[model samples]
Target: MDVLYSLLDVHIQQLNPIIQDKTFTNTLNFILTTSTDDIVSITTPILDRFCINILPTIDHNIKSLILESKSMERILLAADYPSLTKLKLFNFKDNIVSYYFTDESSFRRIFREQITDLILIYDKNNDITVQREYRNGIHEYIMKFFHNLKYLSINGPSSHLILDDSSPTTCFSSILTKLCVYVYCFQDCLTLLDGRLKQLTTFIVEIDHSEPSSIAHNMNNLPNLTTFSIEYRCNTTEFDIQVLPLLRRMSNLEELTLIIYNENRTRLVDGTYIHNQILLHLQRLYKFNFYIRTCTDLNNVTYSLSSDNIQQTFTNIGYRHVKCILYNITRMVICHAFSLPFISNHLEYLGNTFPSIVFTRVTKLLVFDILPFEHEFFIRLARFFPFLKDLSVMNLHPQLCKSDSVNYDHNQQYPVIEYPYLDSLHLEDSYIDYVEQFINETKIRLPRLKILEVDYRKLNTITKQFTRDVTRLNCAKVHRLIMEKQVVFPKTFYVYFPLLESASSYSYYFKK
Candidate 1:
């Protein structure tokens, strides 16, 4: 509960009198929430006070708890909540699940008999992990554990959650009515849609890769499912085999959401393609939200297709707040279109081609551009997305026009890019010039910047071996410094980032 703690700390002096009020202190549900902020831990004192003074007082009133694995044990053991039914567990690992969820764990009764809604959110794991075998056994254990579970969701950082559990035991969830999950492949996704959950209504999934299996594909469709959504993170070319065919079977869907982006020169997922291939087949559908981006080679375009042509298609469908941009640059016809306001909290791939609207809701953004992201583009971004907390830039080129951006001598050339709410800045896949553009106090001002991911050599060189005076202000507040490789720096490095609590290097993190 980083936001809670921060609010309490910020207003503690004024709120001490109010905090002492019996009415205020008696409401302990605020203490039961997991932190939405990047800083993912609660202080020991906060935990101790919560367990000792607060939880027991309002134990019966508690109905739900959202907790990270680190503090989950202490909080769960704090009080007996007679009314508790829902749980959203984050940062879960296999070992942690085995210790607490397998066999005779203390939470066995609560999980098996009490909880009806469960959300297990794990950290990104490429390897098959979680409660013995994530690929084979985790879903089985989940279905087996929660007896009265009506809604169950399992999420991961990436689409590669990798669940290979096609066991007949998991094939049926009699009590489950809703499921939201991520799978490694389409076969695993088809396993979920294989007409096992007779009561299942809402099914949301994000799959990494798609490989059609005739046996799984030919299995019965989800006729009971009224709500359905599918998202693709990978550049998919299998709409005919993977996506559309699956949709043709789910004819009972009432609400549908699709977020798809494809780079392959397959059919461009425009209005006509979506209508004929997808929506036309789903006769029972009423509500729809979509964000479809297609990047096709210019050489492949046969007919006249312009931004106006694409815009009219969306307009015909009565999508009022839709934003569509067509960029004919770098020998690729890149079309970005999405219905607003943007629903996803973490937008996947954004670039220089952006709409001039405030995406106040989006917390995480990935900026990828073959062309350089100059100072103006950054300024436009910071100005529009005022509440952006996480930004990952993956541009490989340096700023093309620096004269309009950088102040060489004394004249302030451009307005400094500021991210007042940003906590995480990832420049690990970007050029060193971008490193300099951000770290240099003159070009950008990151007041709330805490997490920074950069190349070790680039960081060192740009910071002038950690003694650069110009970059000190921007580097001063970085709490977690992520690098390509582990390297112990001089005393100046620590001095440069005085608030840096930790430094780490992950070769795997850079592979993204």
Candidate 2:
């Protein structure tokens, strides 16, 4: 007979090490299935020594024995375990319609003392919440036993669980400090009394679109909180920013992540500016992340420069100076208002009008974008931000012409115009023909060239011949040829592709 000692979940059978050694007992979580008899037969004495988890007598009965015994069959049980800490039950397909607390009292009597962190996952089949009278009796039994429990997780809809005024009295008083719930409505938050949440440190709420105010109000209530996340994507309505003053009250807050959908109105009111100013008042907040659908929401904001200038209004401020500036220029629409100028143009203005802006503060600038094929504005863009260490360019658009110039090469005979101290260059695009001349020219000039990523666009016989000629030159330190729609390598056109780990369109090849 094999004596097995292990911590096991039957779902991940491949990764689990089979119990071959019996020298030491192990902490175990044995998930009971139809093959449990075989498991018990293989490892009995080893399991008795270790911390093992199995369905209690009543839970085991529901798993086996399909016949519905409705004549009020009672079972007797007894257990004594000291090392148990975490317990979870997912009795979705158990068909627990007829099992009452009085009948399953033997199983409850054993579990009520040992279990600490309990997670119960309820689904359609064994949904106790649907049976009101039976669920209430079961909850009463559970609350009485697991009084010392700290972490509690209840999954499923709120409509399933019946909560009256006395529900909190039975369960939510002395023990629980961390609570995570998936249900909606302010009713869940309002129901949790202040006494129960006084010692609470972390609370995560996954609320639906219908209850934004409830999420906001709960954020206000948790004064002892350190981390908070609210996901309200489906909700069409905007959360009232009036809650900012209340949120400012959370003095101990360290991290906050707010993900909100786009609002219908573009023009933000002056009151919104009032709330934006409140962020500076937060003395403890070191890290902040705001992800809104529109940049138009950032319009209008005031800040304090010093005690001397209390009347001064400032729109944006970065606490610590950032060395690199990343420009993401996709899906941005501006119809000629008092909008900011193009980044390269803005940099030029800051350098000329405010000469102190360049060569002193920022060290590097990385621009990765697909400029419109029709416009040749990149020549003008290359002039600004003269002190860049790493320059990365990605052309996302499909079509491009060879004559379109984004000049980086400066001739020795020309006027003294300092080139950017560009140490690394990363280029990726489908239009390699358009950038062929630029690549050939810059490869010889850029002495500090180290890394490159090139994705070739789909082409016919003529274009493939052109690509082979470029490949044979073998100019780049890391050159990769990506033939989209197929993997057709050119004959004897060997080029070193140190970085060609995999291609993007892999599955498309198999389909063809």
Candidate 3:
């Protein structure tokens, strides 16, 4: 209903004159279709009045093609009406048309400067028989006409846009800052744009996937660019030496996104080693995201591994190397490596406290998949990172289920005992037994515990022993008890009335 109203609103002005007029007001509703032949004859005067602009089709069979006075100038005059802000042409060929209109003296004499946004969409319903020379001419004229244009979009056929080393270039120094190009045009346009579009800060390019590195290599030289997104539908192995370095050089760049498709079985030279060498040099890149196209299906790359093969293939990628390098990082997201197989080993390595003690600077750990060693390892890991605050656990392994689980060190009687300064905890899809154990352990430890979030899907083993133990505890400092599913209530509950704020699924802690 909302969509229908919005669609009708676009033609509201046209509809108003027809609806209010005494002559055609009797026709409450009408259906308009393009298949009919004599629309001009059948169309009511009211409807005709509203038909201010006819977006002529490029189809050869369409009878209502825009053919005003058989000349380009006359056609421009015919289409250039106060109500018509858009003009679309198809199967349009020849460069002479634009050259004749856009000569400095010619444009001043004829057009008198009225056009702002110009669009030329081709290759949709036409063949190569279209005039190539005319197409080039049209491009030249349009660029010159729209010097102050803010938005320009071009989508053309791959064949028509092939560029030669000597291809003509356009200058856009007249403050055309925001530009988006989703063209199938030739790659030489990149070189032509050199030092021309200086004011452009925001750019978006969706390239033809047929040829891989052509677009990427050309885009590397864009100077003073801050925000960029380039998407390819097919995959190619060419690294486009310019892309990586250009990304590193964009000191003012805040947001960047790249979507690469892998259509061909092309193997990329492992550039992680190169990235590692260059990381130290990229002083401005405080945040970085790197993704690769290993397959055609997006999901294939997303959830690439199952639990069975996770651990074995964990250490192969540059994840370990990169993680090691960026150990000091606080906020980071590495997508492809989110599965159980990849993360378990990294966690285990951090958790291990053996012959030699290695420290992890990570304070807030967010683990996705549950591993068998998480429950046991975190107990030891907390000892090392004494100032750790947030511990968020998502999918836990069934094997980590223990009866009375607590943050207990098996070697408590040993020489050294390290205690972590944990404040907030988030447990999802955790067993009831583990939850009870966690709460019991926190009774004696975590004196500064402020929030506890528990999402227990299966509460099979929330026995009386667990409830009794929880009731016996005095966690006076704990303020929030957030429950998603029902909690098996302990024998007796201490309701800290004044201190407790709210018990809800979603919680917020604002950072000043």
Candidate 4:
């Protein structure tokens, strides 16, 4: 028998059994090094038990600790962690910031010499007005305390916290190698990386559109940087020109990811030029991911490039290592926007004007915001991507119904569109009739098909009833079925399919 232990949500009742078992106790001593929870405060009973009984036994084994502001002092004082090298502090309050850095505090001695990796997360729930000031003060104070700190992560709403250049307390450790923070401007990011963090190799920052040109100029200062990522929220095409030049400066970058929420209308010509430029410039880049998001209604949208245009654009540039997808944003009850992956390589031919392009090597595809009316468009996708294995479609317009006039028998006379390697299919908020027909038609073509996931949140009462009725007739060779909600199936389903068991209310798996 194998047993796994987790420190999350641990119950006091469960502790007695583990304490009694000598083998389990030994395992606990080895495993319970890191406190891995975002708990605001530890209850007195749990705290007392941990300090008096638990910490002393496993102190030496602890290599890392993650604690909330309220419980950090009590837990650290419980026992000496000689092996502790990494510490993460969360939900920090302004009042307790000075205590930990003071000479009289126990943490000063423990962290001053040994700690190398430190993560400080500000409480997001706190008043936003004061959080900024608190974060800056805490960051400045803690930086002075850790003499050998190499890796630091300051996570909060914004990475705008800037250290005073003239502050006598400013201690930029030469040993620091990696930094992750959210910056308000590009200059502040450069200030930290320019000369202060000379040894920094990995830097991740979130910046606004304030100073795009400055990035390319200042990036050269951090010659040691190997991996760099910038996330910016902009709705314009002007940033593209600014970004490409920046990429050219980072010749040392091995991995790069750009996430932009593009609000401005983009044309195919501009997109094509940018795509080609990245490939031409980033010669040493091993891994690159580009996420461009736009807000537009599916009812009236024009793709800048067609599938053929996208394929030809990349082909023209002699680049085939990228994949582009168009998503249909659906407004859900809980979330503002829920997007479904839609229109992979062949989306160019989908008659929509949205520019879609992807590498020929891509096997998995996600398409979103497809009109339920287009049945042939969906079927033709499999024929385009012969290598497609997994496909997920979301936010399908609900009005479109499967054509009852078309005879499957007559259709069988023609050459069937096939995806021989296709394995997994996922549909979200789409019409069930069309899905059933698509699956039934493609069953033989998809021999490797194993999983089918359907989200029927938008299915009407009549459509849902029709769906349940057609399940037996629409049966495909899929091994697993995952639904958004629990479904009541016909008794015949179980009789015909004995191997299938309900793994959960929303999931059904084949036992075999």
Best by lDDT: 1
Residue 404 of model 2 has an lDDT of 26
216-252 in candidate 3: lDDT tens per residue? 3334445466666555444333334334454555556
- Candidate 3 residue spans exceeding 4 A from truth: 1-47, 51-112, 129-131, 135-137, 158-160, 167-173, 182-189, 206-223, 233-236, 240-242, 262-292, 295-512
TM-score of 3: 0.37
Runs in model 2 with CA error above 4 Å? 1-79, 91-103, 122-145, 156-171, 190-196, 211-221, 234-237, 241-246, 262-282, 285-512
State the lDDT of candidate 4 residue by residue for 162-250, as single tens digits. 54342332536578888777765555555565466678788787764454433322346345778887766554454465455566766
lDDT of 2 by residue, 32-56 (tens): 3332111111134443432233323
Q: Estimate each model's TM-score.
A: 0.81, 0.39, 0.37, 0.53
Q: How do all the candidates rank in terms of lDDT, highest first?
A: 1, 4, 3, 2
Tens digit per residue, CA lDDT, model 1, 1-512: 33333344353668644444444433333223333343144568888877776567556766778776778888889988777889887766656656777669888888888999988776543343233444343666677767889998887653244445445556478879988887767777777766667798898988766555555433576788899888875354665566777787787989998887676644466676677787788989988888777877877777778777887787776666677777776777777777787766667558787778888787788888888998888898888888888888988997887752233423467777788888789999998889888888778888888889999888888777887677788889888898877887888888898998889885333122
Minimum summed lDDT over a 10-residue window in model 2 is located at: 345-354
How much does candidate 4 score in TM-score? 0.53
How many Å off is the CA of 495 in candidate 4? 46
RMSD of each predicted structure = 5.6, 16.3, 21.1, 12.8
lDDT, candidate 2, residue 278?
A: 45
Worst 10 residues of 1 by lDDT: 26-35
